[model samples]
Target: MRVVTGIGAVAATVAATACLTFAHPAVAQDVKPDRAIKYRQSVLRAMDYNMDILEAMVKGETPPNKEVAAQSALFVEQLSHMPWSGFGPGTDQGAPTKARPEIWKDPEKFKSLQNDLMAATAKLAASAKSGDVAQWKGDFSAVADACRNCHRSFRAR
Candidate 1:
């Protein structure tokens, strides 16, 4: 009876795991436009918070720390990839989003801005690793300008 019970427990666990594994992709596919907009907004907010910290360090409001700079750069790099996928159809109008319809309308320009941001963030990450405050400032400014350029064309005021 004990052996039978153990076998039943193992079987139950396996079934549950299989159910979750198959269910996940289906659930992700069904994510609504509003959810996508909210997700991208959350990602941007996180990036903004990190950027503010880096900016403070740059402006001498806070003492410069290489570890913080490096971590902030890495955070920006990761967050940059989170928003583009959220710019799907129906996301342009349904939710409380600053994103303009031009994101979907002008695909080429949007792609260019995305590429610019990626490159700028990559440079920022590399500069952070070097622990040079001057280099970090320049790289951070580049990232900021990239963001502004995208916002000017893709985001509503």
Candidate 2:
């Protein structure tokens, strides 16, 4: 009886795994638009929080900590590469998105802005790692500018 019960449990587990394997595509090619909005929104919010940390240090609103700034900058750099995937087709209308339709229409310009953000965030991370407060502060400013530029073009006010 024990062996029979164990085999039945194994079969159930295998069946569940097989169901999921058949139901979910390997690449997730057709994510729902609302889910895409949620995905990007979460990433953007985290990026903003980290930027706020760096901004506080730069503005003298909080004591500067090299380690904290370095970590925050690195997170910003990683996050820069993430939100673009959330802007794919059919994502403009779902959920409460600030994304402009121009993103879908003007892919080239949108891509350029994404690249600018990535570059600025990369520089900010490097400057923070170098432990130069002044240089990192400047780099942080550049990153902020990139963000604002993209928002102006592709995000609704």
Candidate 3:
């Protein structure tokens, strides 16, 4: 009788798991859009500060002042938290995202661009700590390139 009861419990658990797995997609769809939008908004704000840091770095005096280096480091740290939003089911797709519908259509291209940005940002942050003006300049340019590359493909006017 104990063996039979154990088997019955195991079967019930499996059945419950199967039901939840099948129901998850519909439940996920019920997720509020505002939650996604809020995440994107936070990323945008972080990117804004990052861009400002890059601008300051570019315009700052040669040899790079501590203030400038510190700003760049801050930018890199902020960017580390970015690119949180991309084209995905139920994600924002219009004006603010210009994330071309083609992003959904050609996922590989979008993902590549996103990866490129992440790599460049990671290198930029590392270079910022090097205190080598030349390295910083090169990494800075790479970061800008990544920004332009993604914007051209994903952002609409």
Per lDDT, the best of the predicted structures is: 2
Q: Estimate candidate 2's alpha-carbon lDDT, on a 0 to 1 scale.
A: 0.91
Q: By descending lDDT, how would the candidates be arranged?
A: 2, 1, 3
lDDT tens digits by residue: candidate 1, 1-157: 3554687989989998999888955554467988988888999999999999999998899999999999999999889877777776667866787888788789899988999999999989989988988998999999999999999988899
Query: Could you arrange the candidates by TM-score from highest to lowest?
Result: 2, 1, 3
lDDT against the true structure, per candidate, is 0.87, 0.91, 0.66
User: Which of the two candidates, 2 or 3, achieves a greater lDDT against the reference?
Assistant: 2
Q: Which lDDT tens digits does candidate 3 get at residues 12-56?
A: 899989988878566444556555555666776677676666666
Clashes of 1: 0
Runs of candidate 3 with Cα error greater than 4 angstroms are 1-31, 61-63, 67-71, 74-81, 93-97
The digit string of per-residue lDDT tens for model 2 on 117-149 reads 999999999999999999999999999999999
Pairs in steric clash, model 2: none
Candidates 1 and 2 compared by TM-score, better number = 2
